[model samples]
Target: MPVLIAIVAVGIVVVVLVVHLTGGSHTAKIANEDAAVERFLIDYPDVEVRQCFLSWDRRDAVLELEDGQVGLVHAVGVNFLTRLVKRGEMTARAGVSDESAVDLETGDVAWPRARMHFADSAMARTVVALFDKKVDTTDNKRAA
Candidate 1:
């Protein structure tokens, strides 16, 4: 009887986990990230965004690329982010640097806001997706 109870409990826990993993919120988050990455790509056809690193805690996404560069993206409609900006904790800027500044006569204007930083694994996924490259969805392996 005890063994049966243990098995049942384990099975229930497994089902709950599976359900949570395949839930709507998780799918929406991934879809949003994918959409944002695609938008960034369309905005900057010349530059490539490779790997996407998503952090649920920070509520932000970072893209890693081949050329040893990273792009940080701030999630839209984040209440904390809005509050931070209002509280003077965050400031809005045009570009990370003026070197790769996008202009109507020069760079693509469709890009929302992109800033270049040191390349990291997370950013690579986004850049890869930006160029329509295969994204590494696995958690352990970094882009090769």
Candidate 2:
């Protein structure tokens, strides 16, 4: 019984160490993205936020708009991802075959170009739904 207790205690310690090092699981990542999106919406209430694609490390959120525009919002400790969004220079490419892959351009000379990919089809669908809901709500409010 003593041997079993020691093994269990070691296992718990290992689990705790792993969680602490890795900063938790995918659910935690989703939660971080949710909070980031909320903060972004608060800052830009009138801007249509279609979707927020989380970076692999969950430290940044790439926000997609209804008109195929995109922006980035970084965590508190990170540097600003780009100034194109702030400068209103971000524009979608004229033609693109794959809906999942987006080519972004900034008319401004200082802003760098970027390509964003939404590899997950389910996530793409979810984004579409979110955009549709926002558009519908805005239309309803305008009509009233």
Candidate 3:
């Protein structure tokens, strides 16, 4: 009986350790992007949000502010993953087609530059405030 009890205790300890190491289940870590948008709307009632779009593959969100500035709220380090891929992880199934791999790779390495134009500094500030609420800012200090 003591051996059986000991076995059960060890099993429980192992399960707890695995859960802690893995940092919880994927579902708990995953947030519904739509819910995030709703939260933004609720939080910033002053800003008239035009649109909110979420990335298909990841949790990046793009929100259009009332003053016409498009705010990009993304996981800060998500781009690092793309950078790593561009550094030559292009396998046969890395979405590289024979017809356009070279061109695609060149574009990947020299990613297009994006310019952010705000109507005024205040508008920029409001957009940024909304963005911070939406994005997970812990990964990058630039979010601060």
Model 1, range 61-139, lDDT digits (tens) per residue?
5555455444445444322111101111122222234422211111324433434332343443333333332333564
Best by lDDT: 2
Candidate RMSDs in Å, in order, are: 16.9, 11.3, 15.6
Candidate 2 clashes between residue pairs 3 or more apart in a chain or in different chains = none
* Model 3 residue 89 CA deviation in Å: 30
Judged by lDDT against the true structure, how good is candidate 2?
Answer: 0.54
* lDDT string, candidate 2, 1-144, tens digits: 999999999999999889877855323332466666676666666667666776445554667765545556654332333221532345544226656544556464654554544555445444334323233457658899
Candidate 3: the clashing residue pairs are none
Worst 10 residues of 3 by lDDT: 80-89
Q: Which candidate model has the greater lDDT, 2 or 3?
A: 2
* Candidate 1 worst ten-residue window by lDDT: 80-89
What ordering of candidates by lDDT runs from best to worst?
A: 2, 1, 3
What are the runs in model 1 whose C-alpha is more than 4 Å off? 1-33, 76-144
**TM-score head-to-head 1 vs 3, winner:** 3
Model 3: what TM-score? 0.32
Model 3, total clashes: 0
